[model samples]
Target: MRYERADLMTGMVQEGLQALVDGRHGDPFSILGRHQYGDLTVVRVLLPGALSVAVIESETGKVMAELEPIHEAGIFAGLVGSPVPYKLRIEWPDAIQETEDPYSYPPLLGELDLHLISQGTHYELGRTLGAIPMEIDGVDGVRFSVWAPNAQRVSVVGDFNAWDGRRNPMRLRAQAGIWELFIPRLTHGERYKFELLDAHGNLLPQRADPVARSSEASPSTASIIASSKPFRWNDADWLASQAKDRTREGAMSVYEVHLGSWVRIAEEGNRSLDWVELSQRLVPYVKKLGFTHIEMLPIMEHPFGGSWGYQPLGLFAPTGRHGTPEDFAYFIDRCHEEGIGVILDWVPAHFPTDVWGLARFDGTALYEHADPREGFHKDWNTLIYNLGRNEVKGFLIASALEWLEHFHVDALRVDAVASMLYRDYSRNEGEWIPNQYGGRENLESVEFFKHLNSIIHDRCPHAFTVAEESTAWPGVTNSVENGGLGFDFKWNMGWMHDTLHYVSDDPVYRKYEHGSMTFGMIYAYSERFMLPISHDEVVHGKGSLLGKMPGDAWQKLANLRAYYGFMWGHPGKKLLFMGCEIGQETEWNHDGSVVWDLLDRPEHAGIQFLIRDLNQIYAKEPALQFSDLHAEGFQWAVADDAENSVYGMLRTSEDRSSHMLVMSNMTPVPRYGYRVGVPDEGRWEVVLNTDASIYGGTNFGQMDAWAHRSPEHGKPFSVALDLPALSTVFLRWRG
Candidate 1:
């Protein structure tokens, strides 16, 4: 069994030493530790069986130094420079049997306490995932401790304490490395924040709790989270069920959603649905949509109202705008009950504002670099992570693991991956630092991404890790051993852009531009991908799918149906934005409702029906499912000129027992009878149609037809009928 991210790190390290001496094993010593970064990491011995026990850095392949064993039982320590990759070499006089446990450490119950006694000032929360308990007999007297090696002082302030900013000061504890104080009396339903002092006694900026249960901005007060549980989850059954069926890579068809705008709340005047209520209603609806998963936009706590959750404040806390921590847990539990997996849209890429949680987290460029140019994102105006820093990396990695272990999320779809990969991704020449070759790729970020993927996959094998990688990075979807960033799937922007460009053109213009529509297929075969009409295509200047069509109402609906049909038939997996199935006309508003009334219209209803049918077909048809990523599932045109305006392909399986043919016309003019190639020659059946009356299109061809055998096309049978204008049809070979 590949023990990825097993909780046995400390144990393995401790036991490894005794076995090495007892057997005089001619094997490399296994040395592992939670590296400089708090990421529980292991460096195995590959060449100990060889003479030299040398330690080399994995990134630059430079030798750090020779190592010697410390005179202790099952304990070895070596000095290594930098924290990229540590390699250990073990040597023995002769080969011997394995006797050392090679793995030992104290119980890995790593948690720390963080406390602040003031508000409107900066403070350092201990930079680790060590659990911090409180003595809250009456919801008050909670002690906090943060490991700010550079901070001079720290304090905690909140609604319970009246945002005084000066009354309470956390007494620093030396042995525990915690700053703590016990307040006499307090209760739940109160908000709070922290303040920190730098080396020069300069007050650091105050920030919210990274794991806050809830938050509320108080110009005259700080954010508060009630220390109460208002939610009761059906977790016992959920864990029992999910433990059997976990997440898989291809099994995912995510519906990227924003909770606040997904449904409207009652008291908020159609503003946003409370997390509790939204969970109650959304579970069944998403399951019915046939989406296997839902990747929610950042649910992490952030302060900005208009922000799309790219800017995050609380690292471990769900946004208070929804409800509480338990509330979010209930939401996840509910989704699992409905057979819908949940993946958080995590943003560890960059933090919001330079005055809050991440801004000067430990003082003196602790979590971020000291150089403003290197530390800040100019366009985003956010703080970049000091990924090389040990504590920061640990905090981030632990947070990632915590979500998977605690929340039972099926996966994580990392955002802003392009920015993380290249230091100058959005910068011009001379505007950013370069790699060793003077190129733009940030090797540190690359290593961090690799490490992150390894940790997640190691810890949660069934949990998938996806990247929103925009650049054409090589081997993005390849396995890590192939020298690639390990992402199971990538969003196919090429398909989205090209398909939109093709579908938006007039039918008269489409014939001349058939190749344009099929341009995305050229490179789509390079990687596993998800063709998405994501929120990015709907917001800002880019209009919604329905709004982009250049035609009348019926024509627009028809265009959407054809576009979706084409997308479904194309070579990649599929994802549709929240309101696209109903032909929502308006662009998505992060602060407004989805205009659900559009479903009342026949045109929109027809579009919804088409999507429902398409999803049904996608589920029922194995040819569509397994063949989606392979070349055998898709075939290009045999006739160059005729194929340009028309796309023809047969979806065949490994055994070839059953096959499906999808024929689409990009041209506006109707063809009297089109000859499509099929592998088999028998009776052929028209099983599906994009121009069906249910999809708001006039039924153009015979709903039921049987075609006799034909020798010309190399198929068991051939059909001759009116091919509808700008419509797709699927035919299967019959016995």
Candidate 2:
């Protein structure tokens, strides 16, 4: 009986050694670490391609024992006298190295972390799961963790281990399906990836870290270990005053930018400016142009440059194409220093179908859906996230917070929210799924949005959210408590399409489409709106904003200037894409920069000057800035003047302390004496004229007009003035 028991122990030991060598061991810590069987303390280690390994007493600096090559695949084992603090002294073909054994340390995460991770409420998921630099028992190293619940085995493969999976397989913390490993002496800037085997032991492609804070530039997909040092921010005063200044009652003029295409260094290799150069150039340009904020096309890491940051895979990582994470922080700091806000375009809708990314992570539909109809975004050929899973929704929310709180971003303009809200978005009747109650809404995504928005508002009250929702979904900007999506603003897609269509027609036929110009006022106040001329209107076979106008070069400039005057006078916060301000004749190409050369010509320069003046007037005038939302802010003066193609209105301040008269002539023929209604019977001084010679117009408009006490267009006062051909003007009552 004694002989049989000894034989059983030997067999068990050999089986474990073979599994370790094969890289198929499920419990690596159990088999490859110091374990006591009665009296003897056995130590096992894996030093792949090493000639030999010795156990050194850490405290005494003495050689404890030597390990034998139990398996030819570099699995070494021996009795180390007693269980003492020790390090592995490895002699390889290249050199000798000494390091603390990784398996000796305890698990990194505590019970609270496990609970939060399981419930998908971990706001610091980025800090917890990714490669975090830390010290364990006075030994500095990187603690690598990943979520691959379905993976049978996971390993941290990098240069330290000679890129061998068998060198440092991670230990599974089975409770949350998280795998972790502490590689002693690993430091910042080390590149690594997770190698995994599926449940059936089938090898899978290595995955880039989903929570990586920094990554390699495109054409390479490894995650770089970021520095653990805290970045010192110089925007304290800006942050303290931010919440008070950024109210819904204040003006918000966003200048949307695709950083990769904004200003290419043409003299060089046609490369885009880095974060430092962007700060030195873009900030002053926006400040000079009088824009309140700059909204970026998603700066998150993506494999494809052509996606323009819409299909992102690295949610936590800033793209490495520009610079380090610290460089990004510096750019934002510079913006705040200049009193300009930053809004990032965030995409939580879908991700590209890259096999080595989050798609089929762990050899299962882990992050995305399994069914084709439910999971696939056929319109873009992407994969939809499985928000039904708590972890997935939590991951997205965590990513958003990482940007808003950690990166000091002022707001997040969530992209493609309409796609996530509806189950049948861009799908035929049979090619979609329904909710539990047989509705078209994606219920899980709805819940996720409410939760995400509520949490952001609760945690970061200074920051806000915006939605790029094109559908007529009700209460998009309403609070979640009020049965809405809880966004601070919604892009007015309807207004953009209708007005652009109206202006694109020749002045000879603009009267027929005049209704399109006035149609927005009917439903303008349904939600907190932003009149956005975004990147979508300038790409994909669509022409540039300048190209959209139908007329001669001179008339097109006149028409565009007039349109800018009307847009500022309209009742909504504003957002305009980059090249639209300069009147780039060509469509926006992601490969090229905004046509900065156009500013040399008077025609394009005039449009730029018009936009600059419009922004300044919009900021200085309380009537234009403060009254964008309330119903009493705007009143129609001449809504039904389609025959001569003219429109007029009055904008009142929030407290009724100020007022501005805005009038537009859509035709090329000037009206000698166009009578318009006014609220005050006195001298109405012309504040700005889009047709003025400085704006490259026909130089025809009245300098001022006197309002008489006579009812016209239902106003108690009336005024008559010479209106310019294809021009818009702003007037103030000099009472």
- Which lDDT tens digits does candidate 2 get at residues 1-735? 233333222335677767777888777898776776766677778877889999999888798888887677887777778888899999989899998999887788888887788899999988899899999888999999999999999999887777778888999988999999999999999999898999999988888899999999897998889887888999888877776754667778999999999999988999999999999999999999999999999999999999998888899989998999999999999999998999999999999988779998999999999998899998898999999998898899999999989989999999999999999998998999899999999999889989999999888867889999999998888889999988989999999999999999998888889899889999888999999999999999898998888788878888888898889989999999999998899899999999999999887888888888888888888888766888788888788989999999789888787889999998888998889888888899898999988878767788789999988888888999898988899998787
Could you give candidate 1's per-residue lDDT for residues 554-616 as a string of tens digits?
A: 777777877787777776777788888789888999878777887788778888788777777
TM-score of each: 0.77, 0.98
Off by over 4 Å in 1: 1-131, 134-141, 164-168, 171-189, 211-213, 217-251, 265-268, 637-644, 702-717
How much is the lDDT of residue 607 in candidate 2?
A: 84
C-alpha RMSD (angstroms) for model 2: 1.8
Best by lDDT: 2
RMSD of candidates 1 onward, in order = 18.2, 1.8
Model 2 ranges with Cα > 4 A deviation: 1-11
Error of 2 at 311 (Å): 1.0
> How does residue 514 of candidate 1 score in lDDT?
70
